[model samples]
Target: MVALNMTVDSQTGERAVRFNIDALVIAGWAGRNREAMEHHIAELEALGIARPKATPTFYRVSPSRLNSDPVVQATGENSSGEAELVLIAADGDLFVALGSDHTDRKVEAYGVTVSKQMCDKPVADRVWPFSEVADHWDSLILRSYVIEDGERVLYQEGSVDGLLDPRDLIKRYTGTDTLADGTAMFCGTLPAIGGVRSFTTFEAEVEDPKLSRTISFRYDIAILEDVG
Candidate 1:
């Protein structure tokens, strides 16, 4: 396991603090066999093996039990490229995990959403349908960092502005929407030594010369630590 030191900067310089993270062990049983894992997973309609009532008795394998494999190819182009691959277990089950590398620090999970502007007309007021118009608007990125000791929560919030680089691919992918006037938003939360959780919201916009209006966009992020 690796310990991380997070730093915050002020007009003067930088201040740093150490965070202690205990190594977590996750264990879980795969499907009956490697070939049956997917079939059983599909039959159970479960995402991964986290569902409680799912069949095939899947379990969460610990980090120590995780096998090291070669890096997979990147998924989408731009700042937010991702890779998906399978982990083969000698015992007969297949474990799946997704890898997203967007910064110097390692991230366990993330989410993204995109939305567009709304339009009003004499006939009817409507918003851009993402399925119909698929281009427009800018993206916003939200990220999470583990805060240890809870020394400067309020001060850290003010310092978050400088922690991110807008041009990074990971930032772009997670923040941009595919649809026009699309509003993209992402929220990520990292617990004191647990898996990171993320959520996204998207909106679409409609364009028309007759009734054009400016849209207001906003983004908010919240982080909570010490979750078991």
Candidate 2:
């Protein structure tokens, strides 16, 4: 299984979000076509998109490298080999950081869940209500997806959920007015299928002002047949 832990800023340090990811689905894909998968990974590296030396690894795409390369864009459509690379090249400009991983097992495929910890606070407090704080959190989550693979999406279906607003949490912990309106922040995560393409959608809901909630959903479905 693909295990992930997320901590949201709380008055007492940070709290973890509860979720599960099936590793079998990923492993099945890898097992069925390891060579094709490796070739696709090679294409990614050739374009400067680095991967971890181990399984269940995380990766990041530098903004500087992505903006300055042309070959990177040209290689985005080489079948499943270029799925992750295409997503990064298309969406990497918006994020300060990106994280991804894979596993070796076989099971049902659901989706990914991303949690947050308030590393920094906004400039002011009481300026933006709890609902607005939740909205800001939603915006940051939407901006975090940098991969734009036409075939494979970083997220599956109903993957993103349980976003906690740090406004009150930051204020209580820091004892200062840190979360103000229009304050900039970064948060969220993306799960990617190395070779295939997938479709995705984002959504949110504020159940309570005191406790905020948001969910970013992604779905995988066949869009077209063979065309080259």
Candidate 3:
């Protein structure tokens, strides 16, 4: 079991909580807008990745890959990060956080599930109660930045409108509206700003315009040579 030392951004105040996660699900091809989702699929196909057999596919990964640190290591530079909203179910309560579904593009062509498990998934330490943002959920936005030539560039920016509603996504995954206990799901991501590319430092965040709050995190990438 992977224990995440997370913080609850409750209305009262921020409180510490240790969430022991046993299952980590990454939802792919989950854009609510079929047009936008197809744009992403075609984008990947341009790079030799085949389309998913079905939309909103759920890929199961080891819970241990969920990481909270500010530094992540990749075997090479053939990987990039995608901004995503994260859902966590713990102690009978559901909370929402921001995360990056950093993936190995090279491995993805052959096997996406294996590629997902190849890198550490970075998530913010703080989260908000699902109830707090549930009402104005569509007003929320997901964005990401990539460091290129020592300049931070907007890699992706979009409203959650492009993605599936949290409830709908959860139902599709577990045959229910609520997530099982200790489950953390990466809800899916927006397409890239310019195009999909690798970076040395990747940052991601989620903004709730209604609540006037945001949760974010960044990680430096360490590229190690592949030993064969």
Candidate 4:
């Protein structure tokens, strides 16, 4: 289990907990915009998947695949990163964190779920209580930057409202209103600025304009030589 140094509350007292994660669920095609969803569907069609009937598709991943390290290794050179808003459920409480739903692009053509299993998912160590940001949730923004030939350029940016809310996504996935404790879900991402492309380094964050705080994380990619 991955233990998080979480902040429960600050105004009342310095309440913290070591949140344990037992499941990692990836929520795909979670866009609230039908146009954006069609755009993503067209993009994924180029990768070999047909149009999906559901607004949000749930993919279960091994909890052991989650990591907090700032670096991850993948086979060959086709892995790409998609910045997502992650939901962490711990002991009946919900929290939010930033995450990269890093996946193997080459393997994606074969199967999205199988491709999801090909890489380790990385998340920020810091998190915000869902209660604290629930009111101003739509104001939160998600952005990602990637290093291309030594320069950091914006890759993806949009408001969190672009995707389905945590409550709806949780209910859709779990068949309930609340996510069970020890469950972590990676909410889907927004479209890239230009287009999707692989990079050596990726940085992403979730910015809370109302609170004036951000939860961000950066990680380097190591492309191991393909033996085949």
For each candidate, what is the lDDT?
0.21, 0.24, 0.91, 0.85
**Higher-lDDT candidate of 2 and 4:** 4
Task: Give the top-scoring candidate (TM-score).
Answer: 3
Which ten contiguous residues of candidate 4 have the minimum total lDDT? 5-14
How do the residues 62-161 of candidate 3 rate in per-residue lDDT, one tens digit apiece?
A: 9899988889889988989998999999989999988889899999998988999998889999999999998989899998999999899999999999
Local lDDT at 185 for model 3: 97
TM-score for candidate 3:
0.98
TM-score of each model, paired residue for residue: 0.17, 0.22, 0.98, 0.93
Per-prediction RMSD in angstroms? 23.1, 16.8, 0.8, 1.8
- Candidates sorted by lDDT, descending order? 3, 4, 2, 1
Model 3: pairs clashing at backbone N, Cα or C within 3 Å: none
Per-residue alpha-carbon lDDT of model 1 for 53-115, expressed as tens digits? 432221222222111122212212211211111111112221111112121111111211110
Candidate 4: clashing pairs of residues:
none
Number of the top-ranking candidate, with lDDT as the measure: 3
Clashes of each: 25, 17, 0, 0
TM-score-based ranking: 3, 4, 2, 1
